[model samples]
Target: MSSTWMTTRAWLLMLPLLAIMIAVIGWPMADTVRLSFTDAKLVGLGGRFVGFDNYVKMLTSGNFQRALYATTWFAVVSVTAEMVIGVLAALLLNQRFYGRAVLRALLILPWALPTVVNATLWRLIYNPEYGALNAALTQIGLLDSYRSWLGEPGTAMTALILADCWKNFPLVALIALAALQAVPRDITSAALVDGAGPFARFRFVVLPYLAGPLMVALVLRTIEAFKVFDIIWVMTRGGPANSTRTLSILVYQEAFSFQRAGSGASLALVVTLIVTVLAVGYGLLVRRAAGSAA
Candidate 1:
């Protein structure tokens, strides 16, 4: 009877959380899924059952294809750059140095800043006239004149990727640093004593410890980058002939701009499904890596 009472108490404690999740997450997700199958309009409630028409339309749309390509490219480039740069920064900072703590704190400022603020700051820096980027390039003889960075189709996505890397690399660095802190110093020392060079030591001794954290960071950064919208909205607004428009922006434009709620809902579900699959794959890989390490 006492055991039964404890079990009941545990369930009672969980009830509120369960209720909140159902109300906030379950209900909306169900509604969105339902809407995705119908001819829903932003202005009306009487949506007829379309039965995958919206999905077919989205699949066939060239604009949707472009958005998917752009989003994929952005996520791939930004995450890869951030991972490489962040790992390097973490390794450098892990070494003994003067003012290390101050430098670490300073590095976090970019990540800690609000996304909109970071986007706006980069927008200013990329401005054609009196912008830091143009001025620097000119000063270094890289450019003959100040030119619009975000106003050109070719350079717009690249500029956004740079801005995103600046704001996000610190997160990866922090995660990597924490992993580095947990590494067995004794093993590293033994590797050094074995005449292992810096690269060999990092490869044989340090890399095993870093794999798990780096994978976690990669998964997180991939998901965030896939759904990136706010910064692009603030900085480029998916302009330069929609060269930088991503899936999130496409969904927004469909729902709000074109008033095609059904199409937007379908696209949103598609995005969610893609992210979920990618995350699950990463999760499985992490589990396998952990098992192998063990």
Candidate 2:
């Protein structure tokens, strides 16, 4: 009887959390799935089951295809660039020097800023008229005339990538820097004593230690970058000719602007699926890298 009472107490203890999960996550997920199969809209009370029509329509849309390509490109280029810059910054910061403490704190300022604010700041910087970038370029005679960075199709994504790198590389640097701290200094010193050049030392000793955390950072940044929305929205809003349209923007346009909740829900679920696959792939890679490093 005492054991039964103890078991009941444990059940009671779990009840609140179980209820919270059901209310917070599970309920919304269930609603989204259900909505994806219907013709729901923002103003509609009842929706008829359409049975994959939304998915079919979305898959057939050329605009959706463009968005997918843009999203993939953004995720790949931005994340790769950030990883490279971040890893280098981390290595530099790891070395002792004057003002290193102040610089370390400064590095985080960009990442600590609000994403929307970052986006807006970049938008101003890229503005064709009366922007600092244009003025500086003109003063240095780099450009004959001011160019609208975000307006041009060729430069829009590139501009966004640069801004994203500035905002996000700091976080990656922090992660890589932490990982670098765990590396054995003795190994690096030993390599230096063995006449290894800086390149060789990093290639052989430092990289081996960083492999696991680098993979972890890469996977995480990739996932985050893949679903990026707000920055682009605040800056370009997927812009002049839809060149910067990404999957997340597609969801926003369909759900909110187009008043098609079913399609929006479907698009969101698609994104969730893609992110899930990425997460699983990262998990496997992390385990393999960890095992190899160990």
Best by TM-score: 1
TM-score of each: 0.96, 0.95
User: Per-prediction RMSD in angstroms?
Assistant: 1.4, 1.7
| C-alpha-based local distance difference test score of model 1 | 0.95
Question: Which regions of candidate 2 fall more than 4 Å away from where they truly are?
Answer: 1-8
The reply for model 1, stretches above 4 Å from the true place, is 2-9
Sliding window of 10 residues with minimal summed lDDT for model 1: 285-294
lDDT of 2 by residue, 42-110 (tens): 676868999999899988999888999999999999999999999999999999999999999999999
Evaluate all candidate structures by whole-model CA lDDT and list the values in order: 0.95, 0.92
**Best-performing candidate as measured by lDDT:** 1
- Over 119-220, each residue of candidate 1 has an lDDT whose tens digit, in order, gives 999999999988999999999999998999999999999999999999999999999999999899899989989999999998999899999989999999
